[model samples]
Target: MNDRLNLFQAARFGSPFGSPFGSPFGSPFGSPFDLAHQAGEYWLDAWQRSVLFMDAMRQRGDDHEEKLTQAAPHVLNFEFDVVMDGRDLARPVNYSLLRIHTPEGVVVDANRRPFIVFDPRAGHGPGIGGMKHDSEIGVVLRAGHPCYFVGFLPQPVHGQTIEDVCQAEARFIAKVAELHPDADGKPALIGNCQAGWQIMMTSALNPDLTGPLVLAGTPLSYWAGVRGKNPLRYLGGLLGGTWLTAFTGDLGCGIFDGANLVSNFESMNPANTWWKKEYKVYSEIDTEAERYLEFEKWWGNPVLLNAQEMQYIADNLFVGNRLSSGSIHDSAGRRIDLRNVKSPVVVFCSWGDDVTPPQQALGWVLDMYQDDDAMALSGQTIIYALHETIGHLGIFVSATVANKEHEEFTGAMDLIDVLPPGLYEAVFVEKTKDTVNAGLVDGNYVVRFERRFLDDVRALGGNDQEDERRFAAVARLSDVNLGLYRTFASPLVKAAINEQGAEWLRQLHPYRLRYKLFSSKSPLLFGIAGAAERVRAQRAPAKPDNVFTMLQEAWSRQVVGVLDQYRDLRDSAVERYFMNVYGSPVLQALVGLRADDGRVRQLGRDIARETVAASARAKLVEQAGVGGTPEAIIRALLYVLRAPELRAADERGYAMLRELRTHSEEGKVMSLAHFKDVVQQQAQILSWNEEAGFVALPLLLPPSSAEREHALDVVRQVAGAAGELEGEAAERMARIAAMFSAAVKLAG
Candidate 1:
């Protein structure tokens, strides 16, 4: 545990490694003379930190090598004793199936349900999902769910393929299901980043294997990104194609280093990568060492992917964006479609995540379904939640996020299943409890589903038809480049490189070399670790009031600012070159991609429209404005409670209305979907002419006096569901409630 010293505590901004404290609040230095007197101490402190910084760097590198060395081949970063290894699976892949061992005193109910989590295999090693106490696995286990993990080995099996991995995953889910016979549903699958798409593929091919699927910071539409931003998406087109991936793999003797992927990610944010990340650790080494080292343990452990696997992923998924287009096929030649997924999908994304922005995370909905009605008629529930600002890794491991978002989401999975089959935004609203609605809430917040449409996904800054054309062109170019490379370049590259040489080259990568050279094994950094130890005994962190401390922070900020500008400039140049090259109509036509990008989206719209038309004749007719008297009143009430912008959708209120509806002999068997439809119709009606809605209330109200009083009581309960409804909402709710009450008493 790192010490929590408030040396530089001011504005708190969290980094991936740790939420570092800001510069000191007020000046402690009384005068220039006073500051000058302590200058010698400041200089000493600076020198000490510099030495410690180098020593820590050496330790980080040494730690990286030591961890790899000590782990005699089977390195499960997770705290799990492998019960069912991938080697024992039906079609064994590089991945292993392990049951996460619950910590002592964390009594998990074995029969409740199993929660299987897959960490992203992008570049880093597995176990990040379980890296902290407050995490996806941790919350689920505490909530009494049996937990399982799908992790991969450092090295791939000789003939392993993605298809084999997906098949193996299905077998893993089957085993989990076999273990928990009493679970209400199948294992709830949680996939972070890269694992997200894999889970979707597994669930799509084997529909019976999964329950609800949670995809956190995962991009299904690989080409989906905002313009002038998310430059990582531009690399394929800028570099001509994924031919580089093949060339890289060939140089590595048919293996792709995960470190290379990690380096690419680091390059995206130079401010963090070049300066701020290390500076933070160096400045607060005494208090940040534990966290820095913990994160590094996983960060340093880069796994390997087979050359074929890399080629397939880069060609089919990344550059081609084939998943969204449904062009990718399984081993059985059946198309792997997102629409084929039987389980509900819960997509959680953050606006702050540049890697997998909200556009990339949720844009597939628009690519798959043409309109909201088509989505609603599919009988598949897709729920999405967007955060204001949390970075990619924060989605998986941030303590505050894990407790709030993951906690609420996991708690509501049962409710998610029972929800009407449609597109919904799973909204979490903070509980004010100012009103008498305490009985309605179980905790400090309430989770509700707001109806969403395909347009809502399109609004996230992706979905440009023209930009997708360029990506399609890149896919075509990639095939050509990869073919040429394999024919002309691969043999020579492979001949020159063996396993030993490839390993040596990978270790020589800049990211790895930085750590390797900083270690104590290097004579230049000799005795530094020992000197740091001696300095630690009389260590003194600079006072924030100190002028020198302020100057140091200012210098760091300036350096980071310059790096950020450079990153922006580099990204601009990259995007410009990619657009200019790939956006050429002649070039696109030559590559046979001129018509593809346009056709994919058009086909999606056509399928959705056709599905709606064909299914509508066979489907049940909607029951909006058709339910009996009680439903009319409840629907009217739903309209009023929608506040100004129609924000709050109280599940408890909906429950209360259903309970009340039972009092009268009307709408007893009405499904929630029918109720929702009625609510939407009524809201629309009220929006047209608010006074007309009030005047028309008498028709919906019961003629009998006793029933009129009963309806008013239900209205009161629904209105008060959120507790202490305030402002305009409370006033509107009261006015509407009174109108219905009056209409009921005076009904003809």
Candidate 2:
């Protein structure tokens, strides 16, 4: 085998909870009957567990329905008051804009910028983003920001499309701004998963309406992913394109089931979906029930989408992969171009997230601009933070994630905005115990922006033009197949199914039935409650040493492994079939696929306009980069800060310092906006050409010792407020101090 293959084989599997039983083989001398005696005892213990397991399942089902019934009509995870109903809008939809009512003790700073969050409407109800106290809303509330939530009804308006939803969200944001007129700036937007793209589209359309944008686990560049991973991206092509999606929506008789979307997510990892998730719960039901049921409440409350909405997404987004390419246009002929958004964009995604991988989250950067210089020339500040091992859901909802990543993200919004237009990877910094002046820090962890380039993003995505062509061909085929299906099968299917029948079919879905069977209505589970009580009173769970218990675990693991193997084999077959069928040159030619698969078919038209505008902006960018003293001062501070190779606290300290100085007695004489403009422009110029920017510092600052001394003091006051400087940080500060001192001594 090749070296790579050997490496893969070795790394794929890890020792599982290491076999405590040691060997399957037992005492060789033991008689069959004696073993049978022990086995009988083990069987009784196992039987008791079975009774308890059944009882737990029934209670879970009961809880599911009870929660559903209580949450009827609208189920919200956080407390909020309807600020403005969507029905009041000229173009109405079954959505609402809510102003979250913070808990009594949770202090909210009315002057602070408002945060508007939108949860993904992909197959699940809203509130996962704010379901727990330790969530996005929770984090925002803790930070004293007035929070807002944009949520939708369970059923969509009869003919709602993605465009309509975007309009409503834009309206909601505008309303949020109106409500917070006293606030410092426009409301910041945080969109999770599918909502991530929705907000981006809205931002592009109404660039002036929103503030900083945070997209968590959002996939803008759908086609960008690593090979041998992100298998779900291939499913659309494997399933013969979105024709099946249309057919499925028709079968639902106008409303598509979100449960199917959830199922698709589950099918991606059968080991987790079929066994591990449930096994973990079953193994620790005593302490697991509340948490398991809490998550299930959100997972199980699948929402419905109008057939129009689903088709629009599947065709335009999944099949066409058009959002990142600027191929999607709204009804009014306004191109929904992402580059139009001027707001600072912060992307939070994890490398472990299979649903929306890092490549998909970041790949859009590489696709949208020709290079990093092109991006900066456009005057956009894009920051992306990557977590090492969190899953897709954890990116937004995990309490640990919220407390650290999201807290830091929200606190640094101002800092992100003040940053010069460029590309950066936000890296987390470890906190030292002895850091001084902790009062300025907003969160536990510090984050530093590490300058990066388009190359870095493209490297992760490995933009394979070959794969692009295949997907393009698939899109072409999807159009053909969808046309055929609508002409032939769509009418017949629609004619046969009614809303009533569709509801029945939905209820009968295995996904729904799993919970229904545990309801009090199920005859088989009538006595489970009583039996569970008895089992609970006389319970005796077998320990790990029990032979039968060991055997059961072994058997269960084998079954899960077999299911995983089948899943892998099936996925492999599907991928192979898709590639073979779509890989044909003839098929590609028929679809008019070009050398680069028309991946940037629209780039020629878009980039030319961008280039001319960028050219106009270039002169300004250069001047800003090389401006006099203010630019030099910021450059010097940034150089010292970065020299330590340590992550400093949030950029908030710097932005705040600028704000505070502007309002100070001395600051009253300075133009805050002009100062910020100078700082940002100078910082960018220095970053673009560090060596020259460094050389120009002394020329910009006064040659006198008193003035130089005063500048250094300000830098120390601002940078040190967030934390004490040590190690490389201290060294860099010392170098700056010495340089300023030398200037004065030499002058004399």
Best by TM-score: 2
Give the Å error, residue 233, model 2. Answer: 0.8
Please tell me which predicted candidate would have the highest lDDT against the true structure. Answer: 2
Backbone clashes, candidate 2: 2
Per-residue CA lDDT of model 2 for 368-438, tens digit only, reads 78876768766687899989999998998799999898998888776776666778888776565654544
For model 1, residues 648-718, the per-residue Cα lDDT tens digits are: 45667655665753544653555433443444456444444456655566666667877777777777777
- Model 2 alpha-carbon miss at residue 308, Å: 0.6
How high is the CA lDDT of each candidate model?
0.75, 0.76
Estimated TM-score for each candidate: 0.82, 0.86
Candidate 1 — which residues are off by over 4 angstroms?
A: 1-35, 70-78, 593-720, 723-748
Backbone collision count in every prediction? 3, 2
